[model samples]
Target chain A: MAGSGSDDDAFVFPVRTHFHAMARRPGGIPREQAIEAAESHLHELHHEFKEWLDQELAEIAKILPQSADEVTSDDPWVEAAHARCQAVRDTAATMGFYLVTFAANNLCEAFDTIRSGIEYPLDAIDRDFKTLLLARQEADSADRTRLQELIRRMENPSAALPPAARRTPSK
Target chain B: MTRENLNLHGINFLVADANAYFCMISQSILRSFGATKIYEARNAMDVRRALVEQRIDFLLCDSMLPPSGGLELTRTIRWSANSEYRTIPILILTSDTRLNTIAMARDSGANMVVAKPVSVSGLYNRIAWVAFHPRSFVDSPTYFGPDRRFKIEGFPTGVGRRKGDKEFSVGEEDGPALAQDDIDSLLNLARKA
Candidate 1:
């Protein structure tokens, strides 16, 4: 609704309250009460994130090729997969799922690189998606350490990546 | 030791989140904190309508609303000609972790920028901090809303200052803080025509 105006609507929404006559809230919320209130909301979001991740993973699986060499930037499948990766990146970042967000970001970048005719190793793309899935599963299981490791791997996958996964897909 | 419970007995809140789940979460949390009236808006348009119809005490807005999103919303409210709407505290909630994104939130006149999935403790902490330590809003030619700069530990020379640089700590010259009377009158002024 933000851009709904004609670019010159000086006044859109207006309210006339006796602001000077109204009493402000008593004071700042106590720390304990604040935490208790926040926990309830965050708990719901945590479960919601888990459910969203599951759905995203299922969607990702349907689009992934059996082999990295099958990737084609112009292919509709590639575009769909890239779009999914972007959505995952945005949503996962919101939930503070570090590994998933990072991997998804790289996955988008890899797709972009491929689209630009760069020969980024297709195996790297495959591994990135695999890493993202692993992170999602680990997050579901509350494996915080593994999530951190996946984040590290996403930051520098080539260092710990197996030799086979470092190979480029044949054009 | 003294303990005080957070009491939102009569507070009215407007939550603007594009996601239905997020709206539910924010509303639930606000209720827990003792808010008596909580309004939900799924997009920028609804947000405007809610503002027009309700006497909101606080606002929790998502940065990814639709069409224009929270950034634009913040600008609209902050620059509104109406004093009652302009001074209402706004919290920009989003998942954007990029520094530039946070900077954009600050530039948009948000009272605070909070990252999601926001936890109970994090949300409360920000609310309490903002409530008790409200920053002086500045309406400059190029900027509006709460002052963006805050002091950081060990940054003695101030932001971007070298160790030998002679600039005093930023904000030291603001003098004694504005009195309640001064603040009230200052906030009542319109920044734009």
Candidate 2:
């Protein structure tokens, strides 16, 4: 919803038709139909969330290089990066995508830790920045696995899947 | 109980919400206890990490924060040895009154939850009560309503009329319902109920 125009509009339409149509149907689309609808909407939401994550991570990766080298430029773009990262986090949480959420959350913490290390001492910020960059890289790598797991979750919300380390303690 | 021995030295507390108003409200609630040391984090991770690395006593955590919610932070603090920053009492401050949010907050390791439009007395009652009995819910012993702060703890709690200034009847425990003849008073209390 932050960016402009009709793309956001598309997220609402087809699912909405199914929603309204289901609402008016005889006795609300039977048990099987209800399950079908739930699965349908969840899949849509999952895909939508993944698309958003992919776009944001790509944008962040692009920004890292641009901002990393320019010493005079915002000397600290960490806060802004965090602000953008926070937006990604909130969306993941609201969507109940905890794996992605967990990674994003930890990544943000690392960014803050490095940013806070900015003191009169010269190399602290740079050292922190390097640590933060590693964290970002690790998160980018983890996103693929999380995205696949999330897609699987959409297919069967109740599936008792094998416990992956990434899923547990996703708090 | 009373604002007695709660003053600790000049501890600086920081709050870092992108929302200035929410941060201001949190600052005011923390300041009420005369605790000069308070800090705010823009989100959970920053605050949690700083709490471990610094010296902070009471933490007021927001349940719905960006990146990760406060629960994740609480877990990290409680479980990780590197973050054993004492069993610092944490009171989760949230505007969300939803059952799921409350459950989520507790899941995150909050000792208690405070609903928002945060009130000073509510904040005080919650903080003191939690600090007094950390990890256990304290049943509020007195009824808080419009006219007075009275009790139903035993021996005809309210006096025969308003016996001048006050009198203490220190026996038994009585329920909220008394004579309906005091229906106005009863209704007043009932309205709150």
The model with the greatest lDDT is: 1
Q: What is candidate 2's CA lDDT for residue B189?
A: 64
| Tens digit per residue, CA lDDT, model 1, A1-171 | 121221231112222223212223346455565556556555567877778778877988888776656455666677677756766776666456777777778788888777766666667877888878777777766567777776776577686878877867689
lDDT of 1 at A68: 56
lDDT of 1: 0.67
lDDT of each: 0.67, 0.47
Enumerate the chain B TM-scores of all models: 0.76, 0.59
Q: Which DockQ value does candidate 1 get?
A: 0.18
Interface RMSD of each: 8.9, 27.6
Task: Give per-candidate clash totals.
Answer: 2, 13
lDDT of 2 at A77: 58
Best candidate, TM-score-wise? Answer: 1
The residue-by-residue lDDT of candidate 2 on B1-193, one tens digit each, is 1222222234445454544335644554454444456676777667767666776655676655666766666555544544444244566766456676765565444556776435444454554444333232111112111112233221121212243634554567666433223534554465456
